[model samples]
Target chain A: MKTAENAQLALLLEVAGTPKPGNVDRERDFPDLRFEHFLAGTVGAGPGLRAAEEGAPVGESFERAIAGMSQQEGGNTQFGALLLLVPLVKAASANENGDNGDAGGDAEDAPGRLSPEDVTRVVEATTTEDAADFFRAFDHADVYVDDPPEDAAELDVRRGSDAIPAVEERGVTLYDVLALGDDADDVAAEWTGGFERTFWAADRLAELAGSAPASATAAQVYLELLAREPDTLVAKQHGEKTAESVRVRAQEALEGGPEVVEAFAESLVADGVNPGTTADLTAAGLFVALTRGEVSV
Target chain B: MKTAENAQLALLLEVAGTPKPGNVDRERDFPDLRFEHFLAGTVGAGPGLRAAEEGAPVGESFERAIAGMSQQEGGNTQFGALLLLVPLVKAASANENGDNGDAGGDAEDAPGRLSPEDVTRVVEATTTEDAADFFRAFDHADVYVDDPPEDAAELDVRRGSDAIPAVEERGVTLYDVLALGDDADDVAAEWTGGFERTFWAADRLAELAGSAPASATAAQVYLELLAREPDTLVAKQHGEKTAESVRVRAQEALEGGPEVVEAFAESLVADGVNPGTTADLTAAGLFVALTRGEVSV
Candidate 1:
């Protein structure tokens, strides 16, 4: 329950953080997607999050979370975030139950309550049915994705439920499906690479916590993450070149101070260059930090 | 689950709404309370809300909710709101299970999913233990309240857990404790008076749903509510005359238009006159509306 609660709080905090640079936050809303929609999405996703905490299969829980989350007016408010969170939540629950064995060394250890290896184990255990469910979940919301490489056309996420047959026929696990896109998708890379970036960002967030407000801590972590990588959603919507430029701008904004970061945020929004994937990653990191008590209310 | 989900959504929506005069909303926060704190409070209150859905006693659920809600850094974000929500959620759960019998009429009826009469019955059936728990809950947070009448000093909420003995000795139910303050507290009035204002405001929200953004509809309903009555929190903190003047200003702002309402909201925040109780009522109203499908994600 604590893990699920913290995951939900992470969604709220990520969206509430200001100067997030081209992402929806308390102070800014895209024309079609308002802050209230995110609030509704967070509320809607609760039962599914609880499902994850109760040890439901990651794919089923993620699919359920996305279905509920898409009920809000905003389309796809937290799809990528939930993709990262559901498995993490399941892993945290496993750690609590000592299902992780020695992977999570001590239950009482604050920062190690959730182990990246455990999350990787959970994802790697996904079945073909999980991959099919992931495709079905994609149909629940309109998410942006670049065209898949020609060889992987049968497994394109954009095919939504239509590609489920191929996924089942090929016996592709959810991890396998994500691994296919790991090169271009940061979220997929996290799934295939033991959640490397998510854990790193979570550590950064832990270090910044208590020195500032949670939202400010989140914003700093967001800036750091955005500066470090080209946001996949931005890359899909624009191009890799534009996404790389946004990363450079994020780095400069971080070096230039708060006012410059605010200005960079304004420019990105004005240009319709949303680093949505970075925001999603930040939410995931927050969930990790929260579960470890590195961040608290 | 639906009842609890709607109740949680109500808390989020109430805080996310903009131009809510003198109260913390998406666009405004008191110096001591950032928007993130309310988000945290909402998340913290989830377990207690789920308890209500599972038929936990109203007092225990309310106390549990407060204990969790006060975990946030902002001291008190939704004390009055939860005071109204706990019994209402319990009533909704009972209605769902057909425990409300003929009082709630048919199950398929949309707006009749929760009955005011049922909520009143639920509150009226509270035990002395409930009153003790309510006082114990008060010790969890710093809430603003006027001193109790001289004759009822033993019942003072400011006494927190210290007043529990008097409440227990008097064999006061939670309803009785609230009834004693009904003349001064709008939230108490709702409890003892069959939740009349809450139901009325819910109907208003129902009428306004889908016409605009949910937040805008909420802001409009908030203006109407503030215009109709002096906010109890405002009256307690700033005197009856000031509270009434604020009410008059709300009425004028409603007539004067959105710009006027926004300006009035700024002025109230500037003056430190927060209509917190009115905001609580709005949240209760949103919960009722959400449960009835009058409002949706």
Candidate 2:
């Protein structure tokens, strides 16, 4: 529950931050998901996340978050972030037991730090039901996704929970579901790749936020990530070429600085270009930073 | 725990809403109380507030919130808000039990809504220990307040828990301590007067948020309250005349519409005027709106 809040608070910081170029901010509200929807979603998800801490499966908690967000018009405001947060929550709980020297079985001698392997074990242990709940969550939200690969046509997320039986028939795990789309989705990629980029962003946020404000440091990290690579969600919504061009514009904004970043934000909003994948990454980064003590509060 | 989150979320929303005329908003942060500090305080206070719902004294939860806020450099970011929220938390819990028809005693015929009497009963029931915790809370935070009146010299808030003996000797309860400042402090007034303005603002917020956004409605309610009367905190820090002048300007700003409100915000920020008491009330109002179902997740 604490880790989930850490992620949401991190998300709120991201939402309030300016000059990241093309996301809803304190000054601008998306037509569907205004800042309030994000607030509602974060708080609404609190109960289910807390339930997970007490032994509920991560998928059920996640579906609860989706239902919670569904209360607002903005259907899937934090789907990507929630995907990243769930395993982290499990890992943190394990770390808590490890710290108290009570994690006697598989957790024996686990380090104080919530490890990548801790998250991996948790994600790998997810059941077919978990996978179905996740698909249902997608159906409940207006999440944007690229066309499924031909070989993975059954992976149509819009099918919602109806895809559950097939998932069970194939004996596919939630990990397999993520592996299918890891190539096309950054969030899916994190799920399959042990969340490497999120950890990297967390380290960067902690080091930078120490000297400046969390909001400013969060923005800097978001821009750095966006400039380094094109956001996959942007590629999915707009074409790959446009995503690449957007990354180039971010690079130019970085080269020119804050004023340039502000102008770049203005242009992106005017052009209706939103790099949502990067924002999701920022939320995951914030979660990692908070749990890892790189970012306080 | 959910109620604590509700209170804290209301506080964060209050802190973030902009053009609020004089307090910190998304675009601005206080040097002492960073928005992060407020975030930390809210989350840190969670456990104790939850414990209160399970039967702990409201004072203990309030003190817990203070301890939580003190962990940050910006001590007491929401002390006044906490004062209002602690009682509300208790009221909400009682309301929950009443809803289940398990409230066997005084709540036997309680209505669907959380009443002013519910809050007053919860508050009036606080012990002398709560008063001591409150004093300790004051000592914990670098809160802004006027010089103590001569008759109440021994009531120096700086005395911390050390004042417990004096409080006990005088047989003064938590209600009495707030009553001491009731005439001079808006937070204290809320406690003594059944939170009349907060409920009023909550009604206004529900009405307004239905048409617009919760953030916009919260900001609007704040401006209305500021325009209606001089804030007691402002009157304390800058004296009655300056506070009165601030109120006159707020009234004029209301007459001039949102553009004038924007201009008023700019002037207030530039001139170092912060109507903190008004912001605290807004937090309370938001809590009422949220818990009352006038606002939703």
Candidate 3:
């Protein structure tokens, strides 16, 4: 109980205080949750914020609030998502309202719903995203991608960034969860599996990029591989119409221009192949594309 | 330089995907910077997020990327803040463009703004926030909150709770800062000087509560003591409302009158007194008075 209280107080201080040097050295002081939770939560909150800003139904209000949050200046999809959860957690912990199985009121007004015990439980559980999942479970909100309105997106980002460090130590990968191969739907399972897979894929792509000569084919192969992944956010941003346009523009810009291809390739090598950025950019079809879809480990 | 690159890469990996727990414990992986800089730059990205959500400006677009991070989440605001500074610092070092102005578009897009040599400079810099501050000094965005909002006053209950550890460490008294002979603002000035001052003041208030008998006089004294200083968010929250309304509410709610006062004092003693909360409550008159202005404190 004391630990829970301490943790709560610590979190409040962290949120309210300046990001100091002491926190970097103090393991216990960092954000205790996972990074994706921040991303998804903030992104998720985008929808909720839209609702609130529009004065929609309470549920709708929450959804729009999340969406509007994503559009705001912060639009840190991850943090915005978590901030949306705060109210949900506070409400869900309420005494069932004696009727509608949902949460009740604020933490101060509603005691047992979010008790010291619950806070402790959250602390004991690692990962920012996981804590978000638990809160989601408690609140029973679903995850879908309708593209949280711009402002909602911004708010989600703010909240996610604010709380991403807590679970930095959990070491969970998004690619692994994605590699669970489309069967995973639940947020927790899908997120973890996808993280692992993204890493694995990113690593493989980097290796492939290494051997291939500086050519458009190599870039195309990298881009194709990145495109195959199934993260909705990635899909929406990269595989959608805008992404296709960017890819075509980039491709056309280099077509029949062997000199440009070589120059771009040299730049890639000189820059030392940041696999993550390359993969993301490839997915987004910003500049280079890889010819082959399959990469060997 | 190597450390800066590694820290930057680490943050990119961690934020871009799911990071590993093992990676988080590896302190050497992250470059040392001042805490304040980190708060203002990377972790301070919170403002960017807020701006993004509100659609305030184009510069906030960068902030949208860092939402959903915190000490509790795997976001690693500490490292992320540092990483954010890399580009800025590198831009400073890369003067090839001959453009010294701090416009995001002009400098951010400049070729070779961030380079291996600049990365090295950042790595060699001591203190996390300071490293971050190096980048921020050039781009001084007003992110910190200097005063409470005018319409709604803040309530800082956590200050009371935070004072406990400091009080235990330093055997000092609140009277040291108060010096009773001076004016109230002077008392406030000294009281808010540092952690020690705040802690001593809270401790002294707790001690006074313990000694005073449960009565209207005791409550009045509590109000007076709280009124002497108001530094936290909680105190700010009370500043907006009329003091008389607050006093009347507190006075009317005391079911057992003096007995209630005694019980409240006992709770303070037992809990080690949370000056942050108590002070705000007292000032608001929620804890003692019925209306704002009825009680000066």
Evaluated at residue A33, the lDDT of candidate 3 is 27
Q: Which pairs clash (backbone N, Cα, C closer than 3 Å) in model 1?
A: none
Task: List DockQ for all candidates.
Answer: 0.63, 0.39, 0.02
Residue-by-residue lDDT tens digits, candidate 3, B1-297 = 111222222222222311111111111112221221222222233333334323332223232323322322222333223223333323333333433233444543344343223323323322322222222322332121223223212211123223334433443223221222123232223223322232333343334442422122224433444344332322243342423333333344344355554454444334332233322222112111111111111
> What fraction of the reference structure's interface contacts does model 2 contain?
0.36
lDDT of 3 by residue, A1-297 (tens): 111111121122222221111111111122332222222233334334333223222333333334432332222223222322233232222222332132546553344332333222222333435333322232233333333234333223224333234223434322221223234221222233322332333344445543632222234434343334333332343444533443443354346355653444344334332122222222211110111213211
- Model 3, residue B138: what's the lDDT? 23
Which regions of candidate 2 deviate over 4 angstroms? A1-4, A52-56, A99-110, B52-55, B99-110, B147-152
- C-alpha displacement of B282 in model 1, angstroms? 0.8
Q: Give the best candidate by DockQ.
A: 1
| Candidate 3 stretches greater than 4 Å from native | A1-142, A146-231, A234-239, A244-297, B1-172, B178-187, B190-297
User: Is model 1 an incorrect, acceptable, medium or high docking prediction?
Assistant: medium
